[model samples]
Target: MAEDRILVTGADGFIGSHLTETLVRQGAKVRAFCLYNSFGTRGHLDRLDPEVQAKIEFFTGDIRDSGSARAAVQGCDTVLHLAALIAIPYSYAAPESYVDTNVKGTLNLLSAAKELGVKKFVHTSTSEVYGTAQYVPIDEKHPLNAQSPYAATKVGADQMAIAFQRSFGLAVAVIRPFNTFGPRQSARAVLPTIITQIASGKNEIRLGNLKATRDFCYVKDTVAGFIAVMRSEQAVGEVTNIGSDFEVSIGDAADIIAELMGRKISIRVDEERLRPDASEVERLWAATDKAKALTDWRPQYAGREGFQRGLTETIAWFKDPRNLAGYDPSRYQV
Candidate 1:
């Protein structure tokens, strides 16, 4: 058979960049879509090894514009949509922006995919859509309660994608990943936030609510899940969760990373960092049985291993004078 032509939107970000690299390694002709910036920055994709960078076709554009989205999707067999404003704290400050970028942007992509007759559209989702996890292991059918503006927009985006698949036969699949963490992750994410601070020689780590528990998956494993979903016919028009079944509280996670680093640090809760009580998803744990059955995808990295790997890689990156220059650990990132 012919090799798949793949377009990965948000290829500039953490997981997207890794996914783009993986596709290229697997012999896919990849067009990497990164958000346009005045600096002509490619984000993490720019940091990828030169060999991988050479294999990718780069396009700078905004997902909010249908013309741009359609242009990017054209001539591609599969479209992996991962672009969005993902910071929960920032979403609270500018909700309309999230709705525009996440919801409307998704609408534009789905419409373009439908028009372009793409073979498959993998829609990325987050476990936050199932707020607080009323059930132990959140299944696909779990009720979606958007606790934060970010989660609300993602919920809107996922529903819109599925609607197009069912109503217009767009061949869309929703892949919900829970807390993917790794080297390229933004410091705004909890894992990177804590690791960066401690690695910066800080004796005290400032954080938000530490009681909330989360199910984290390594970035590579999460990317693998995406590939599995794309290859599986059974995943079409279906929602599959990519996550480690294990759960850990923020406090415990911080301690684990600190212990791994051989550092004894005091963790202080920053008021500005805490989410509103009602808006906070107290707990999130995912059920991957459907994914295992449909895509035969299972998380290869457990909590401790995943956490250590992410912490080790992230710490090494942040320790680099160049990478550290990009991050301000003392400042509370949105």
Candidate 2:
């Protein structure tokens, strides 16, 4: 790790920012690939510890462009591809954009990695690719059933990543994580929506599909899983599930958050927040045995107790005035 030079795509976003900071702290030479913007903003990376920020080489470009992808991967020995358009609702309105960025962008990275002979190429995948769970704890062997355009594109990207390894002998791996919630998360996610509204002193929380279940992994655990996958030689050409084997329904999660906040609240079903009936994923729970076998990685936060502990920490962070300053809880975020 200390000898590795890593390139992290989507280094500007929630999980990406945390991963970048951790890599630098561990002494890896980190190059952060942030989406180019006119404002010169580095997303959450801009708020990282000054020392950590100083250590990262921030490159701004579009992942959809092959030229940009190659340039970013040119000198890096390893690449962690986390860049993608992730919002499900937005994906319905812009399915073509999802294909361009998630699928084509992934092909661009895979091609570059193969050409450069990267030692390890870890591509990020989401549990959404599984759609509604057919079994209690979904595993790597689970059949992919994408209900949304976002998930479909991810499935395409993931297969292309593995195909590179099979076809060109590149060292490629994919890590699929379940619902990940933490500080710095945007309101587009349900947990953030719940926490933000509560922090804003709202009693009536707006939500959708309360019956759906999720396996929520804390950000720190997910980051550790990514690092584990990166270091394991057994992970090449493999897809590992990184999640807690614990499930909580959306309705229950909101109630739990309210309990932790010591606030009694009611969930108001927001019509606009509901997904199309056929597009909704009714359940998700990950089986993480493969991750443990590969890298001895396990969620530090596990089960009901750990879930609550993670929520407590997240609540404390979002409750801070400085942290909550930019979040608008009044509006429904897609």
Candidate 3:
């Protein structure tokens, strides 16, 4: 038997970069498929340790291109597809792009993976796919109601992944994570938006839908869940959610973050930051039982205490002057 060689699409993005580094450190051969850009920017993957970065086989190409997709997947045993346009506000502006990248790009990868006989294909999904949870602890069976174009594209991509598995017997495991937060997160995300504003010495921060609730999982926990799903044969053709069982409203979360940072901060709703009335996902709470039963994956950061611990670490990372320099806290990030 040959060792499993992995190809991680979107290796330049936040979570993908971390996963790439972890796989390299674990002595796995990884081909990192980063988006090609004129400036040669590798996104967050450039931040990895010199030695770790050196060990990765870098393939700079666009996931939207089928030729490039197959080239990256060639000789790889596992495909961790994470490339997609993920900003909700922007998705509202350009939905066609989401379909091209999220749905079509996934098709290209699935086609390539099947053609090459890849052993496993781990597809990424989001809690946004479930909309404003009609029931508490939304499980794999929860009805999907995409509240935004971004979520809609994810749903499309997820369905395509499952379809490939069912139609061709291509190994696929869909990992749906709810509100993962930690270091290296872009400022566009709610947690990063709040933390960056506070770090930049703002007493008042602009926000939207603070009452919306979320089950926030730490990045490490979420990444571990993905690995567990990849290792489990039973997870093939299944969807598992990675999240903290606990939930908190965005407003209360801000208060907790403020307390953790020792900063007294106030949040004011920025009209521009608010999503359209019907598009806002007001609540999300993940039922982690499926992930546990299928992959033996448990979120180390669960509940209010875990949330606080995760925030403390995240705050410290953002407080570092070097890390904070990458973001402009004054600008409203979409």
Top-lDDT structure, candidate number:
2
Overall lDDT per candidate, in order of appearance: 0.90, 0.94, 0.93
User: Which TM-score value belongs to model 1?
Assistant: 0.97
Per-residue lDDT tens digits of candidate 2, residues 1-334? Answer: 8788899999999999999999999999999999999999999999999999999999999999999999999999999999999999999999999999999999999999889888999999999999998987899998999999999999999999989999999999899989999989999999999999999999999999999999999999999999999999999989999987799999999999999999999988998999999999999999998999999798999999989999999999999999999899988777
Worst 10 residues of 1 by lDDT: 302-311
State every prediction's TM-score relative to the real structure.
0.97, 0.99, 0.99
Q: In candidate 3, residue 89 scores what lDDT?
A: 96
lDDT of 3 by residue, 1-334 (tens): 1278899998999889988888888888999999999999899988889999999999999989999999999999999888889999999999999999999999999999999999999999999999998999899999999999999999999999999999999999999989999999999999999999999999998888989999999998988887899899999999999999899999999999999999998889999999999999998999999899998788888899999999999999999999999999899898
TM-score of 3: 0.99
Please identify which of the two predictions, 1 or 2, would achieve the higher TM-score against the true structure.
2
RMSD of 3: 1.1
Clashes of 3: 0
**Higher-scoring candidate on lDDT, 2 or 3:** 2
